[model samples]
Target: MRVEDGFQPVPFQEDNPYTSDPVLPSLLKRTLPSSAFQEINPDLERLGADVVTTIRPLGSSSRVYPPRLTQYDQWGRRVDDLETSEGWRDLKAYGQKEGLPGIFYERKYNEHSRSYGFAKMLLMVGDVHVVFCPLSMTDGTARVIELMGSAEMKEKILPRLISRDPDVAFTSGQWMTERPGGSDVSQTETVATPTGVNNAFGPQYTLNGFKWFSSATDSHVSVALARTGSPKAGSRGLSLFLVPLRLPLLRSPSDPVPPATSNNIFVHRLKNKIGTQIVPTAELSLEGSEAYLIGNLNEGVKSISPVLNITRVWSAVGSVGGLRRCLAIATAYAKVRSINGGTRLLQDSPLHVSQLAAINVLYRALTHLTFGAVRLLGKSECGVADADELRRLRMLTPIVKAFAAEKACAGMEEAMTALGGAGYMEENGFGRIIRDSLVEKIWEGTTTVLALDLARASQDPAVLNAFLSWVKNVVSSCPSDLHERLQKPLNVVNDAVSELASSLKKPIAPLVPRPALILAGYVTSSTYLLEHVIWSHTTGEDERETDVEVLRRWILEGGMVPATEDVRRATQDTDARVKADSTMIFGRSSRAKL
Candidate 1:
């Protein structure tokens, strides 16, 4: 006889993420031509089902079996052998075969190909255990090589990076951080001396340095920054190089041991991170590692900017993906979950529904912001965009990246709480969602660091003009009746923009960088959301009511614009605020001012 164990919550059952999503298909249909939509939609639906049924289970297994590193052979030889779980390997191979990195280059739908690729990724990321981290770097590296690599380099590496054949495909690493400086690459101490040899890859150089953090340590090749000029040259002293992490894959087994094992790269240890355990990050020592110079010497910063832009976009999308997954689970659970001793379903409860509603608004807005930027990227890459579109993409990149990361972190937390005690449990999977989402804020760039970048870009007259003009154009295009319906929210965005533009003229821009960027993101996202509403009306869609309310709540309930008093305090009450803050932080023994 079994004893009763009280009531057990019904397990949540999530539908296909791609089909259950109300926004993605509509956005794609509105933006792409009918023929292009016809070509992509079916494939997206198939991928959507695969993510839930196949990819998700594999991802869970990956976390269960984390990677291991073996530093020595039985004979006492120094061999840094990194071993990953079978599930991780299978998922990676699956992603490669499905064009995780190749879709961007395939151009099957021309400019729309990026949307197809990103949409597929958006669905897959919810369950891939962050395998996308290394693949993100691979995508960025491909872009760099395609745009900047010499003929030999492009011919050799580009094919493998974009290969659909899993056995032949390659993933790349980005090794930029050093012990002396994390984000500050200007202080890089790595030295690269010319080896005076030209190989199949490119001109050879020997890199000798210690890299503090190398994400995706198991990659085949990496793009690194090393000083090739005077140490005093700051960022200008750094030059970009292509460092192969392993010997040529096609080499015969008896090819003289390839001169050095692991291409003279030694992995000190894998990082014990809070999330993304599936990704093997490492501390590395490049001892006479063979590398090929990428572009003009001492122009590493300028050359690597393109890669940063691409990865930042990936960061934004990854954040939204994580939130969407948690929200879906929470939503599914609420409908069947009962309260009041089975008298009512959780979804029927007003308070619970209200919390879910707020999170939905945030998720929708972030989706628009992230995908809007992706569309601009596609246009710019296809060489079809005019000057203003390019400028808008540049401005939107950091703003969307910073804004989405911060909001998604908060949104995921709220989503977890919606599940009650089950959310706090490790087995339910919300733990992984929250932990992985936090990295989005730190990687690519921290919220504060990206806010500074936004400040610099907003100060540029051209970039500022491009963004403001876009907001005005989008808002003014709204139907007269719809504009009247959304008049209050419209006015809110308009006023916020005016105030931000005014603030940019003063020195307060630096002091209120985060708020300024966030305000701009809200304003920009409002425009995109408004544009979607307009599209719905024009197409005679039935979901216009819910769409309109989402926009309304985003402005009125969500606090799209920061308070003027807060901005004033940041600029005006700086000395008092700083002294108090420092006193509290330092135990009243420090003298500090803002």
Candidate 2:
């Protein structure tokens, strides 16, 4: 039977890590008490069962390194074949049956294919990172969600995707960033001119401008944001287009084949990067690429927000997984490796214990935050009452993206430190984890960019007040005993909000500078507040009684307030001090030279 026949897309489980036992899930449940934890328990258990049933245990010396090469090669060759029509069907059939190919396949392909790396290659070829674009492409997990939602699109693509049958993967490259734009959709410059369907051109758009970094250099399909109405239309003037990568075929092909003629899209060059070397980043020139609009003209950003929201959350999960892997490696090493006295490092040192404990706590908090977001997405998908949940998801996506990415880097760094000198070695995988974790900050969106976005969103009294009220409700609803544990940190957040509201009550100038600082403060304050609230809900105990009770106490005692003040003062003081020091040093040097 064809693999496609066996293909059954697994519904996304918020907490299903591919593993062979219920150990991880049981641990998570023991550690966390969020509603998401309860919701994800069944799925986690199912996934654990699936792992045991499917994967054969390789004996005790089976190396995690040099993963099964033939399987990896087969997957890569299949994807390569899909670049053409005849091969796409066969490959799609395999993918459909097996579900999304894991990172092992991705690593294998990058090693074998010297010409292009994962998502990045698409950018080099001027195709948006769709399926073919390894660097920028959303993984199979996300693609499955998108396919599930659109039966029409699914019907057209699933057969090919599942059968390993070749058909063009119509993954959309998101080209919304600009030179001065920091994830601000309103600041985009690419212009899309709608050309009414003509006998010659057919239904098309003439894209005129540059996109700094585009994914999937070979992807024939892209959803570009362009100015359609007014230059100042900001996001309102922006429109989305579903543009084909190639010119219209004179006639439809007898088989599923990408068109022969190239559209005007061209890759200027690929970006050099620190890690994720398998994925390519491309500079793109859209010198009259033929495109068609998707959704209403003015509602492009709105339509894309949901996609971005979902993808951002997925990215957070990926980062979490990476961090978990880092911690697991570090923990294992700590227990086994000997130190100064021929004792295991973990046993010999209090500092090591503290680091491990801190990492564990962070892992718990971040895992809960990420899983909670995933649960929110699942609940929204399953038609749970989530209007407010959706908004909360929106607010949290940037936070999760920013916070998790930052924490993942920090966590991995700590893991590296825990390993001492050995962590720096590339063979240990800590280096790779560090390199990979760097992208988490810049991926989806940067912290500073998201901070500004949050700040802007906060300016809208409605969004701001609603969010504040929602947080207030969450705080108020906590168990009475938990209130004592939460009250101090909660009060700090409340005070910050009140101060911000007072500042915004009147018109203010230099909006960019001060607002930026305020936004940072807001993210820090809100993140802690949300963390405390979620912890309160999930732990099912008063905050004072839980394991993170110390953390909560730390935040309340002086952690939250001092952190806020330090951020504010540091932002203002650091630059001026640096400039003054530089000036004084240079002047003294010149005088000495004279």
Candidate 3:
């Protein structure tokens, strides 16, 4: 008799998270100095194996149980500590030692630092159970401070932020949202008034406000926005301040506290989030909190751009990490799966093979797209990027961030289905995979917000030239037969770009148009895959076969629904769309029961 519960392997290999990915090695090889990345490749690859073998299983259990808020000690001291499983702390230690988060700051790695750093981050997030959350904001905060902080701020904070030393290491908070304003930072009511206080910690501003969504609430320091000028100045009027959770207490005779203590940041409550449960996100009440301004006063909105962009990339990487893990699970399950008779391997089933392959195609293309953006980030930061590369890098950010998150949601659902009922069971880990990936679509910025940002970037001439010219060059470079193979999708994509340009000519266009956003992302992602594969072929790297398979699946095989001619037609007819939208939003059905 066969046991019903004996089958553990899904369609995926259950392989090491790092080396198992067919895409990562070649990508790093191409984007980074081969010598630098290759030197570290074995180490990262082994780390990847270690993560799969050790860290992930630990995370699966630890994140499920999650950390709890211990509001007080047994003696009734208000410690406000978030107590977590040892595995959680272990992952943090791994981060410090491996330089997983700080690798982005290592100029020794040359222009490839972002590529190599994010490559490690991509693998780490897969099964580290959203440990990427704090790391993402931490890296972003470090970058922001490095770029805009006063010399003193840099001297005081940068070392700790980038330090691999456990004793000196720090993570940071991004406290941007208030209860009333989600993405609208202009509506932030947090107030910062100069205390007329100056001491060893530099200038001080007293902050009083409520922060609604403070991710990494346990962080030692944070960057926040508050109105330092007229409330009417909106986002432009706000200032960016680096608020340390615990500040150095001046031992003045007039002061009530010790030389170093809590900076008056009170944790009001922890959010019981459906996803990213492992992260200690909380609501905060700041009363007379002290902070130092990081950038120009009232340029807070602009100054925070570096943080926003970097974090969004991490969000994209994290989305792919979740999808990659799910696919790994699904692929392993399919290999040993059988009919009730136990005679036929699910791997031999044509339908099953095709299903997994379809998702793999997406995984491959998105991996290239996301990593390509990282390469551009490094180039731009290192001052090697030309005008065109800079424009592409700038625009590619929103496109990749939104696209990866959207596909991760779709991919995880398919992953769950492939694993049968066990996928829904908590112990199998698919519950967290799907649940965690769901928030990816919501975090950083919702799809609509990112799409709008993408759309705005598409209209600029430099961006347009950078994108269109590259697409044309890539498609045009294909040898005659291969070029012919790509012609239809290329034309379809170019038409979408042309339409976008035409629409932008009209002053009354919506900033957030779904069709335009979808078209831009699909076209660019497809092109990135095709171009990379072709480049590999010319250089003798041998990825062209798989690359062609992905291109045919996503572009030529009618895989992208919104990129089709029909959707394009529907979007162009503004009058009909308006009427349909009005009927849907304003006019209910005539036979409505309500």
Candidate 4:
């Protein structure tokens, strides 16, 4: 009568996130040279094999303890310290040693560096717990310093930020949000008053205000946006600053009193969230904190833009990682789990296989899109991008960020459901996958905001024209058979471009058009897949038939007619009562009446 004696299911445990992913390796082999593969293959394989020992403890127990804030000493002396978890700290060394950031900074593979770095990093995304959180900002921080910081600033900070030695390396925090603004930095209330200081660190600014959301609060340095001129000047009057959490030790004992260890940064509280609990996100107060000006004052928004572009790409990559993980779990679970009162295997179920394959098609399409962004990022950074490539990269960043994020949340949810009731359990990791992926949709920029950005960017004739030309080149080369399959989607995308061009002449109503933006993402992502499929076929060194099957299946899954399918889905919401009730939550005042 014991529970152990009864029927029990075989668990999908001890699988490596890196090794089990058949898709990433295939994509790498087809897109990159064998030498490129040789460089990354060892790292990927090592991460795959040793994953359980290295990252499992970090993942399974990471959220069990959230970060704690310590404000003072027992003697009542002010000593603000943010105490994080062991899992958070222990994974740092391994992450740094893996050289995820180093590869890009060093450009070991020349133009292929960023793609190589991202491909390696993407594989580690699901396994690293939320350590990738700080790493994203840290990578962005290093890039900002490299691009804009003064010679002294870059000399002093960039190496540490990209260092492989844990003792010398540093993670970074990005503090832009305040009480009044989220994505709207024009509403910033933080002020940076120049102290007329011309010291070694440049013009010293006494920052006084609150940063409402500060992820990686325990990091050694940060990039913050603060107002330098008239408050009414809005985002244009803002400036970017490099604030070291702990200043360099006062070169000599004779130097003016050294700044405190915390740089006057006080941790208010950590955000208690449903997921990504491994990353320490805190509310911070920056009062009289020392900071150095970076780039031209009042052009802060424009300067920090590069950082945004970098982080958005990271968010997109992370989103793909989460989706890939969920798919892995679903596929892995099916192979082992029995269904129908243990009479049949879940893998053999036609309904179950169809459900997974359908989502997998979407997943594959998005994978290509996300990696395409990564590849272009490498090309552009290496100065190999032409004018058209630059414009295409600009357009693709937002599309991938918005599409991958939104789709990941939805895709992971379906993946969980495919696992049956077991998916809902905290132990299985699906719950974490669903919750973590939700944040990507909001961070960097919400879907609506990004879609709006896309709408705005499309106003440039070059952006649209550049994208269409690239699409035509790829679609035109698709070997006729594949070209036949691509024609409908290509035609729809061409019409979208034409319509967008017309809309540019007369702006679209109430801007922020969500549907059109989403369709852009779908069209662009599918094109990326088609381009990649064509490349794989041309290479002759990779699996051509499998690539063809994947491309064929993705198109069959309704990827081409994104707008039509979206409209259909929207029209299917026929329940007026449910629709009305759904709005009640957002309509706080109306909810009371309901």
* Candidate that scores best on TM-score: 1
Say what the RMSD of model 3 is.
Answer: 4.0
* Runs in model 3 lying further than 4 Å from the true structure: 1-13, 60-64, 72-79, 199-202, 249-261, 564-571, 586-594
Top candidate on lDDT is 1
Question: What's the residue-level lDDT of 63 in candidate 2?
Answer: 17
Q: What is the TM-score of each candidate against the true structure?
A: 0.96, 0.66, 0.91, 0.90
lDDT of each: 0.85, 0.51, 0.76, 0.77
How much is 385 displaced in model 4, in angstroms?
0.6
Local accuracy of candidate 1 as per-residue lDDT tens digits, 272-350: 9998887889998999988999988999998888789999999999999998898898899898899999889999999
Collision pairs in model 1? none
Q: How does residue 384 of candidate 1 score in lDDT? A: 92
Q: Residues 1-594, candidate 3, lDDT per residue (tens digit)?
A: 466566554434477777778788877777667689768789778888887677776665734456788777799877677666676666775776678567778767867888777777777776777767777888888888788777776777787788777556788889999987798898889999998876444567989999999997767688899888887888888989888877552233354533122788877778999988777888888888989887788999888888899898988888887888788888888877876578888788888888888788778878888988888888887889999999998788888888889877788788778877877877667787778878878787888887777667766777877877888788778777666766776666667566655544424245325555566677778778777767776677777777666677777553455554433464466665666676777685622432
User: Which one wins by lDDT: 2 or 4?
Assistant: 4
Q: CA shift at 257, candidate 3, in angstroms?
A: 14
How should the candidates be ordered by lDDT, best one leading? Answer: 1, 4, 3, 2
lDDT of 3 at 279: 79
After superposing candidate 1 on the true structure, give the runs of residues whose Cα lies further than 4 Å from its correct spot: 1-8, 62-64, 249-260, 506-509, 563-565, 587-589, 592-594
- Worst lDDT run of 10 residues, candidate 3, spans 252-261
Higher-ranked by lDDT: 1 or 4: 1
TM-score of 2: 0.66
